[model samples]
Target: MFSTVENYWIKGTPKEQLMDCLTAYKKENLLTLAENQLMPMKKSHTKSKIATALAEQLRHNFKITVDQLTETERHILTAYASGNLPEELTEPQQAAQATLVAIGYVYLFKENQQITPIVPKELAEQLLENESEKDTDNWFLTTKTTVETIYGRCELSHLVTAWNQHASQPITMSEAAKFV
Candidate 1:
């Protein structure tokens, strides 16, 4: 997403204008915005009747569903939320990690040749304390609302096209700074 924004700046879009665009984009993509700050990513699945009912209601209202996270994934999410997940993983854990990443329940970042988790600690705590899937769904709603409210104070199709044009190499900071 940063790449998309950078590319826009590269194509004669003013930085201040791009910042405004990003502010608007953030307002529009609440789930993507909350991925880091407001909520832990977890599957929305539950057998509890109340939770099921609530999930249905939430789905209707927010278009978000609670996925039924596997037991292993739940454990991993718990550990990640608590900041206890190890930097190194066993073979099985590695596979589980891959699944979590694929499902968007977790994100991995590469830095200095090392991969790391970008767990939201508070969100993890909420997930760990959730007694039912309804609680989890409620968290999602709260996060969505929060992101919208926070960025409400703040459209990049062309930028994406420009990014595809230069996909072979990263957009340099210097190159990006020109528009600013």
Candidate 2:
């Protein structure tokens, strides 16, 4: 999932690798989401195609078996590419999810060409649009500057750190901020 990948990236994985893994992961998630959507309608056969496409992409890009991926990785990819969130991700997962959401990586028909704000859609569209560009060949491309920008926002890091701090408790953003 983008959240897990973002968590790893936020913790300091290189952007290129984050983008690489996240891009692959996003596509894979789309396939699974599509499978879920269609399965109950008796169109489950399409999942095979989705899997094949994922395999090829994995082979060409990540250089690993699809089996090596975690459940969050798989689910987030599906949810993101499909422009939705799964009901499952827990609180810590939500912290990563919020980070990704804040960075404007959560919406798509294609990658957004803007660097998101602390609250993502809260900023003026033109301002956000003026700040970045989507790298079409790789939908997940993000810069170190962007990561640094994210870090500069204590509110964001505090939010994640709060989640990290209370990995066991059910805390909302407002409560987490106060505690942090």
Candidate 3:
């Protein structure tokens, strides 16, 4: 994982920066995050509680979700590893990124007027810790079917843009799964 400081992607430690970003999220968004974690949330739960719970939960649960990440979502995180922010992104990419955010696997760091999507360095290490070959038969063909179904015949290069510039950068897992 790239250094958040060296990369200038954050102003503080990843955990602190994550909370800062989480607090900026709407309560509804936080609620989505909690639900995604399978954490029971009360209607009266304060935003702080929700965000804090997610941060803490992520300390233990990042791998489970990472294991299930669609290929494009994994690509999104890999982009951050290399500090290569691209110029364009697609709706399906945005949706997948948003889902990852909501799932607490990704954090959006906003500094000096630019928003850069990041995962905690520790989490990034954990993701690469195993460094196994991509599983080709786990879930359904997430990318092939999802992309072709949504944006017919999109080129591989067009789909590789930075995920940070979409509707919002973060977590989710519905699409953004395919390419050559």
Output the number of the TM-score-best candidate.
3
How big is the positional error of residue 75 in model 1, measured in Å on the Cα after superposition? Answer: 1.4
On residues 87-152, what C-alpha lDDT tens digit does candidate 1 reach at each position? 677777766665554333444544465445643333444465553444434533454456557775
Q: Better model by lDDT, 1 or 2?
A: 1
Worst 10 residues of 3 by lDDT: 1-10
The residue pairs found clashing in candidate 2 are 1-72, 1-73, 29-77, 29-78, 30-78
lDDT of 1: 0.41
lDDT tens readout by residue for model 2, 41-105: 22343444554443344334321322343556434543443336455668756664554342333
- List per-prediction Cα lDDT, in the order shown: 0.41, 0.37, 0.61
Q: Model 3 segments beyond 4 Å from truth?
A: 1-17, 109-113, 132-180
* Count of clashing residue pairs in every prediction: 4, 5, 11
In candidate 1, the residue pairs with backbone N, CA or C atoms under 3 Å apart (3 or more residues apart, or in different chains) clash, namely: 43-67, 44-66, 44-67, 45-67
TM-score of each: 0.35, 0.21, 0.54
> What digit string (tens of lDDT, one per residue) describes model 3 on residues 58-94?
8687777777889888777767644565567687676
**Candidate 1, residue 125: how far the Cα is off, in Å:** 3.8
* Candidate number of the best lDDT: 3
